[model samples]
Target: MAADITPLIHRVRRWPRRVVITIAVVAVTLLAVRIALPYVVRNQVNHRLQSIPGYTGHVADIGIALWRGAYALEGVEIYKVSGEVRTPFVRARTIDFSVAWRDLFHGKIVSDILVEEGQLTFVAGATEAESQTDVDRRWQEVIEDLFPLEITHLEVNHGLLRYQDTTKTPAVDLFVTNLRLAATGLRNRPSESGEEFPAEIVLEGDSLGGGQLRLAISAEPLAAQPHFHLSAKLENVNLPELNESLKAYANVDVSRGKMELAAEMAGKDGGFQGYVKPFFEEVDFNNVSDENKSVLTRIWENVVQGLAWLVKNKARDQVGTRIPFQGRFGDPQVGLWTTIVNLFRHGFVRAFNPTIEGTVDPDNVLPTGDSADGEGVASEKPETPPKVATDDVKKVEPEAAAPTDQPSKKRTP
Candidate 1:
């Protein structure tokens, strides 16, 4: 019995108590790290943004889902570091990111970034002296440097964008809303497929007056410098609604009318070349005569309207012009300012008879309100592509067919 008791004591002493204690401590430390990681990441992001030359902002909140290798941030505001206090150049309500599972495990991270709701306002500096110091690259560089990993995919929804030019005689606030975009193969290097266009992107949105707009783009981002091609089309814009937004910028009412605008552009390195074509099925310049108006203002409005009538193309019921643009993408207005000044300086000369550079089928243009065939759509938004008939079967004796059409030889062969 004494010998058996000694054996039992030895068995009790064999348990590894030290190892168990060590493992418990490690587990507790890991839990603490998991809880604090989001704060640390958010702080790092804020610090990095502040380092940019002319931009400063902070992230309101950040969260991480370690199991999925996903992270999200909310209420990010980036603005100019200035005393004048301008609207935030870029503001995002929420940004979500999800990484590929394999990449997550390999430590070579890449993510599909989603901007749930955001607004980017491009503000013209108060004076030419200030433009030099402002962050003017539209965040192309900042975005590339933001993440440790390359951005492989991108998506956006209901984003808003605006161009505000306070330097003009009357300030202009042009807006685009409900912007949606989808893109793939957006990495800094060649994509896994090694295609010429590393990224293919599609964009759609609404203009200030319910105009439908769409764009297609292909790009080679991994090259020594960025190279890309872009095409855009816009149609069925609401006319009167434009005046409400433009009222502050001009004295008289202006409308886009039954018009369409299309543009094609290409860029490499820092240079961009493009052409914008505007077509008008109809246009009207009206004088806003109200009891509140003074006599001189009414006279001026009428005079401008008259001038528009004289120069406008009236015979074909369509007016159009092709405008060529070239300059650095970073300096979007390099040549644009002169063009804008010329637009007003020689208002009727170009508008009256715009050079017709291209043509479009009016019937194919989607109707914004009602279909002639009585199709009911809740909204004019393009939900699905129009269907195409694919039946290739040949009718032996079609209703209008004569004796013998040439289809018999091909079918027999």
Candidate 2:
């Protein structure tokens, strides 16, 4: 037994060197992989981007996160090489693609995408060569190739949506800045409401004239036909700041005023219903100089000013009209007489409410029949619930705004 103890001591001494060598080899392998992963991803992404038909794209850098199973792309830019427009079509400061943990918990595998400081520009001109609308590009294919997982969540922060018209006298450049958007539940996951239309999207931005723009949509993205509920609102827009665009398009100019607009649209089974309500407060067109003005132009301006003055609500000092329509998607019919009557009704009767009227509900609309046959059935506001003084009845206010109908001022930092 004493002789065997000497052999055991030698074996124990050799074990430490073997373990050290094994650890050193693993450490070197992992270090090499960590350095190489980003290079491989960068090359693959750039190749996919350039494969799009009419666009050229490049990525400045790529970063990998092994623990989270995510990657980030920096300085991604896509340009239209075929168009006369010099500005890039799409540009992003950073884009992150990662696993959607919330959906994963629900037994669904999907991906989440976040884009920061992104810009999408559109150029309008007379010919096809002058316009850069991305109509000819297969950008969706590129996105599908880069990320193999199904996208369930998307977010954009501090974005810009820009439009440029070169055909006009003084090239029109309009943009919405500080834009934020979120789209979730694209794959129709289960929800508390258990509604058929589960996908929800929200968009908010600041327009060129200091207007706050907000839009919300609830949709069934995988439906056979388009089905959705949408509400949009733009408020406190200075009218004079948009004179160039107005004068170019409408042949009208406003010296002073602020405008607020609200609308609701619902589409289901190839049919739709909606109304657009516009409010103008303290608008004026009479301050124009008489020089270089034709007689017809002067008469037209005076007529426009008189009509607004005549129909404006005295209490609110706002002129507004609700133009309602409902019909098949292929051919829509506007309620011309209803629009004319609303003008008088808005001024003589109660003023049109400067808020979203939750009258358009896709579930309430008839999919087929007179309602969907372009018969011009007017959408009605929810009736006020009868008040019961007794304790047995609970009072419900139908006019109360829903959370989705209210314009949110939330901005991403």
Local accuracy by lDDT, each model:
0.59, 0.75
Q: Considering only N, C-alpha and C atoms within 3 Å, which residue pairs clash in candidate 2? A: none
* 8-112: candidate 2 lDDT, tens digit per residue: 878767788879788889999999989999999999999888878878899999989878779999998998877777788898888999998877889967899
Which portions of model 1 show Cα errors greater than 4 Å?
1-15, 102-109, 128-145, 192-194, 224-226, 244-251, 269-272, 289-304, 307-316, 326-413
Off by over 4 Å in 2: 1-26, 102-107, 134-137, 167-170, 188-194, 288-299, 326-332, 364-380, 383-413
Worst 10 residues of 1 by lDDT: 404-413
- lDDT digits (tens) for residues 180-262 of candidate 1: 77777878666777676777777776675567777777778676655666667777765555554434555665543566776
> What is the C-alpha local distance difference test score of candidate 2?
0.75
Worst 10 residues of 2 by lDDT: 385-394
- Candidate 2 residue 91 C-alpha distance from true site, Å: 1.7
The TM-score values for the models, in the order shown, are 0.68, 0.79
